[model samples]
Target: MKIGLYFGTFNPIHIGHLTIANHLAEHSDLDQVWFVVTPQSPFKKKSTLLDDHQRLEMVYRATKDYTKLRPSDIEFGLKQPNYTIDTLTYLEEKFPEYEFSLIMGEDNLKSFHKWKNYELILNNHNIYVYPRLSKGKIETQFNDHPKIHHVDAPIMELSSTFIRKSIKAGKNIRPMLPEHVWEYVDEMNFYK
Candidate 1:
């Protein structure tokens, strides 16, 4: 199986996340796209993040309808400050038959060098980068790389931060999330 790992905090899964994953799964060579819910990203601040289980559940609810999309809690059990390289290595060993690729945005590629063992990741796996709304574009250095495939996915401006802020401000976020997810958020009173 050729799997594309789309890792994120998913502070709450929204339409933008789903659109990108759907586009990649349909257009790319990937057989499935796994939404790896990161409990705490090594580079991101942890203060504003929701509980790991909450985030995972949101992802599960948001992606449950897509046959090609899967929600994963793999990072939840990993070491604190979960590193992509370690997670990738473990997945490779555990699922030897599956070839894993990375799905990220052009924004992340801009600071790709800052990640741990980034070079090893580039050497061992393929990277499927999608366009982001604010990010300028992918750098020229990786634009032509054989291992890097730039996808022309729709640019969605919706973000989890924006959704959380809107919710706190008593604004409607129904347009940005799936119906089930919106109901789940309301029922759980999350992001309050």
Candidate 2:
């Protein structure tokens, strides 16, 4: 199976997140798109993040109906401040038959070289980068990389940060999130 790994905190799985996964599954060569919910990110603040289990549940709820998409708890047991290279190595060992690709935003690509073992990641796995609303252009160095493919996945300029802010402000965020996710958030009174 060819799986595209879309990693994020998912603070709460929203429509924008789903849109990219859906687009990749439908338009790309991938057979499955796994949303690998990050428990903690080295680049993000831990205080602003919700409980890992709750965030994972939201991803499961949001993707339950999509056959091509599935929620992954792969990072839950991994060490904190998870790095992409380590996850990729573990996944390859466990699922030897599966071909894994990295799915990321253009903004992330701008700083791809800074990631740990970035060269190894590019050498072993294909990177499907989608356009994002960013201030910088993708570096020319990545233009000729055979493993890198530029995908037209819609970058909804929507961030979990923005959604969380809206929820705290007592605004209706239903349109921005998956119905199941919104319901779970409402029921739990999350972000308030």
Candidate 3:
């Protein structure tokens, strides 16, 4: 089995996120796209993040109907300050029969070198990168890696930060998220 881990904060799961997962699952060789809900991301500020379990629940509710898409709290069980390298190592050992690959955006690709043990991650795992508004060509810089492939995952111009701001401003985020997710967000006061 081949699995692509799509790790993110997912403060509230949105339609844009689901579109990309569906796109990858339907078009790529990957059998499933696991939304690895991070307990905390090393790169992003913790203050900007919501509670991990809450975010995971939102993800679960949003993806409940799609078997190819699932939510995970794998990082909660890992050491503090989750690192992609460490998670990859743990997953590889625990699920030896399944091949794991990373799914990320081109925006993240620019800072790829900053990750812990980036060289090991590059050598051992395959990466599927999607486009973002970020500039520059990823292939020009990372094309040397044998296990890397660029994907065009459907993305909205909007981001989680923007969505939060919209909610705070009493703006409608109807297009930014699916109905169920919006209902959950309103009910739980997430991003409030």
Candidate 4:
């Protein structure tokens, strides 16, 4: 089985996240799209992050109805500031029966070279990159680098950061998130 790993902090799982996953599962050949909830990302700011388990649970709740979209807490057991290469390697070794691929936005392509063991990840895994701003392209050195998989979900400018800011300010975010996600965020008092 082919699986696409859609890694994110999921600070608060929002509609854009769901839309991307839904589009990937609906259009791609992959069997499943797992939202791998990152405990901490090596490249992102750490101060504003929500609790790992809380974020994971929110993701799980938000995606419960979509059989094809599942939330993964694999990074919870891994080292702090988890890296993509490490997670991919671990998943590959742990689940040898499934072929794992990386799912990311086009913006990452420009900075992907900076990632640790980037070559190893490229050589080992297939990449499904969704089109984002300017639709970034790659000039890969490794023989089997990330392949671009154009996704056609609605172009959303709102990000988790933006959503968090709005929540903290007590601004209405009704349209930015799913109903279940909004309820969970409110119940948890996240970003407050």
Candidate 5:
């Protein structure tokens, strides 16, 4: 199976995340898109960040209805402050028959060269980049790189930070999240 890994903290999974993942799954050659819920970095703990399991639950609720989308908690067990290269390597070993690719925003692609062992990652897996409104010049080396594919997906400017802040401000951000996720957040009183 060809899988696209969409990694994020997903403090609270929202529509923007679902739109991009679903679009990639339906429009691209990928067989499925996995929302890889990233665990919080032990070194840089943020007060607003939910527990790893809580974030994963939100992801699961957001993606439960989509056949081509699912949630993954692979990074929860890994060491803190894990690198993409390390996760890719671990997934590759765990699922030898499956081809894994990365799903990232254009902004991340701009700084892709600075990632650890980026050359090795480029050589091993494909990178599917979606559009994002951000300021940065992409590395010249990646402009025409075969391993990197710039997918013409819809631009998603909504962010978890914005949602969290909105909730804290007593704004009805219910429309931003999946029904189950919204219920979960409401019940838990998260980000309030």
Candidate 6:
């Protein structure tokens, strides 16, 4: 199976996330798109970021109905401040039968060269880049890289930070989230 790993903290999984993941799963050659819930870095004290499981639950609720999308908690057991290359290596060893690729935004692609062992990652795995309204120039080396595939997916400007701030301000941000995810966030009183 070919899986595109979509990594995020997903403090609260929202529509933007679902849209991109679903689009990639349906439009690209990928068999499935896994929402890899990134665990919070132990060194960073972020109160707004929900517990790993809580965020995972939100992801679960958001993607439950999508056949091509699933939630992954693989990073939760890894060392804190884990790098993508490390996770990719781990996943490759664990699931040797499957081909894994990365699903990232254009902005992330711009800073791709700075990542640890980026050359190794580029050589080993494919990177699916989606459009994002972000500032910065992409590295010239990646402009026509064979390993990187530019996916003409919709631009999602919505962010978890915006949702959190809206909820704290007593705004009804229900429309921004999936129905089940909204219920879960509301019930837990998260970001309020």
Best by lDDT: 2
Q: Can you list the residue pairs that collide in candidate 6?
A: none
Off by over 4 Å in 2: 135-137
TM-score of each: 0.95, 0.96, 0.92, 0.90, 0.94, 0.95
Best by TM-score: 2
Better of 1 and 2 by TM-score: 2
Lowest summed lDDT window (length 10), candidate 5: 40-49
Residues 92-185, model 3: lDDT tens digits: 8899998989998877887788888988888888899878765556544676668888886775566788898888888889778877788889
lDDT per residue as tens, model 6, 126-188? 999998775654555797999999898998889988999999999999999999999999999
lDDT (10s digit) by residue, model 2, range 17-124: 999999999999999999999999887889999999999999999999999999999989888777999999999999999999999988788788888999999989
TM-score for model 3? 0.92
Sorted on lDDT, best first, the list reads 2, 6, 5, 1, 3, 4
lDDT, candidates in the order shown: 0.90, 0.92, 0.84, 0.82, 0.90, 0.91
lDDT of 1 by residue, 99-177 (tens): 9999998888888888899989999999999888764655656777899988999988788999999999999889899
> Which lDDT value does model 6 have at 62?
96
The TM-score of predicted model 4 comes to 0.90
List the candidate numbers ranked by TM-score, top first: 2, 1, 6, 5, 3, 4
At residue 178, give the lDDT of candidate 3: 72
Per-residue lDDT value at 67 in model 6: 97
Worst 10 residues of 3 by lDDT: 132-141
Q: Candidate 4 residues 1-192, lDDT tens each?
A: 989999998888898889888888888888899999988876677788888888888898889999999999998899876688889888988999999988877777667788899778877778787765554444444214335555565655669989988888989997888888888888878898
